[model samples]
Target chain A: MARVVVDVMLKPEILDPQGQAVQRALPRLGFEGVSDVRQGKRFELEVDGPVDDAALARIHELAESFLANTVIENFTVKVEEEKAEAGE
Target chain B: MARVVVDVMLKPEILDPQGQAVQRALPRLGFEGVSDVRQGKRFELEVDGPVDDAALARIHELAESFLANTVIENFTVKVEEEKAEAGE
Candidate 1:
């Protein structure tokens, strides 16, 4: 099976309150010298079999229609290979 | 400035209702041929300056303590170079 990753984030022009909250809380948590924290969603999809171009296109379509709110968010889809364990 | 990405996801043993909901809805939406849809969070951090090892360590600490719920979720962090725009 091929693994597909979809990263969905709000448009740059859109405001992200959750991100702002994290930024604000960082100083209180003693994590200083950081800024601009933007939070988003990531979806890891395990395809039933090998991922082909057709499958990728369908995944993109799904991302556009279901995985992201196009009005405010944008998404990118990519195929990923599982990392081998250490010493494997 | 540099960009860092932190991907946080529930452990394999943890139940992901949001992911399951999407998987169930996909067939209804006519997008099939997919399984094991796991949903997670992605944090895009914009550092004020260059990212060094000290900065990276701090980011990792922040991710472990604030960004991820160690009780059930696991997270990974990586540095990302901004993709140049087309024709740039």
Candidate 2:
């Protein structure tokens, strides 16, 4: 099987209250120097076979339509190398 | 400034309802061949200075203590190379 990774993140212009809450708590926890934090989503997909160009295109469409809300977020899709397959 | 990325994922044995929902919706949307799907969180942190060893270590601590629930989730932290800096 082939693995694909998709990272969905909020646009820089969008306000992330969830991330802000974490940023606010950092100082109280004795961690400092982090200027900002943005929280997003990550997805790992295991495809039935080798990932080809068609698979990539389909995955991008999936990312755009289902994974990310383009109005406030952006997403990136990339195929992850299958180390197990490579080692075999 | 430097960017640090932390990815938090559930343990393999744990059930991921969100991912299962997506996987079920895929065929309905005319996308197929994906056997498994796992959903997780991604955090993008902007630190005030260059990312050195101390910075990486701090980021790791932040990830463990705040970003992920250790009982059910696992996380990985990595420093992203500053492309904007290299372009300068």
Candidate 3:
């Protein structure tokens, strides 16, 4: 099985209150030097076979249509590289 | 400035109702061939300077402590590649 990853993020101009809350909490948590933080969504889809161009195109369309709000968000789709099933 | 991306995902064994809802909606939306869908969160952190080993280690700690619930979620942290500021 091939795993496809879709990362959906807000447009650069958009404000992310969720991310802002985390960033604000960071300083209190003793983490420093973080200028900005933006929170987004990630989706993982398991496909039946190899990921070809057509599959990628279809996934991209899916991302744009259902996974992200075009008016305020942008998304990227990529196939995950295979790794050993056991042990990191 | 450097951009660090942290992707937080629920443990595979965890039930993902949100992702399941999307998966069920896909076929109704005219999409097919997706066996499974899992949803997660992505965070983009803009740092003031270069991302070095120490920074990465610190970010990893932050991801563990504040960005993710270790009991149920896993997170990966990476630096974003620089892209042209202009059009894609």
What TM-score fits each model?
Answer: 0.92, 0.91, 0.92
Question: Which residue segments of model 2 deviate by more than 4 Å?
Answer: A83-88, B83-88
lDDT of 3 by residue, B34-77 (tens): 98999999999998777999998899999988888878887888
Candidate 2 per-residue C-alpha lDDT over A9-80 given as tens digits, one digit per residue, 9 for 90 to 100: 888899999899988899999998888999999999999888999888889888889898888888888788
Instruction: Please identify which of the two predictions, 1 or 2, would achieve the higher lDDT against the true structure.
Output: 1
Model 1: docking quality category = medium
Estimate candidate 2's alpha-carbon lDDT, on a 0 to 1 scale: 0.84
Candidate 3 wrong stretches, greater than 4 Å: A83-88, B83-88
With a 3 Å backbone cut-off (N, CA, C), the pairs that clash in candidate 3 are none
Minimal lDDT window, size 10, model 3 chain A: A79-88
Q: Write the per-residue lDDT of candidate 1 for residues B1-88, one digit (tens) a residue.
A: 7888899988889999999999999999998888889999999998878798999989988998899988888888888888421100
| Candidate 3 lDDT over residue span A1-88, tens digit each | 8999888888889989999999999989999999999999999999878789998888888888889888888888878877322111
After superposition, candidate 1 runs with Cα above 4 Å error: A84-88, B84-88
Q: Arrange candidates by lDDT, highest first: which order? A: 1, 3, 2
Candidate structures ordered by TM-score, highest first: 1, 3, 2
- Mind giving the per-residue lDDT tens digits that candidate 2 earns over B28-79? 9999899999999988888888889988888887788888888888888877
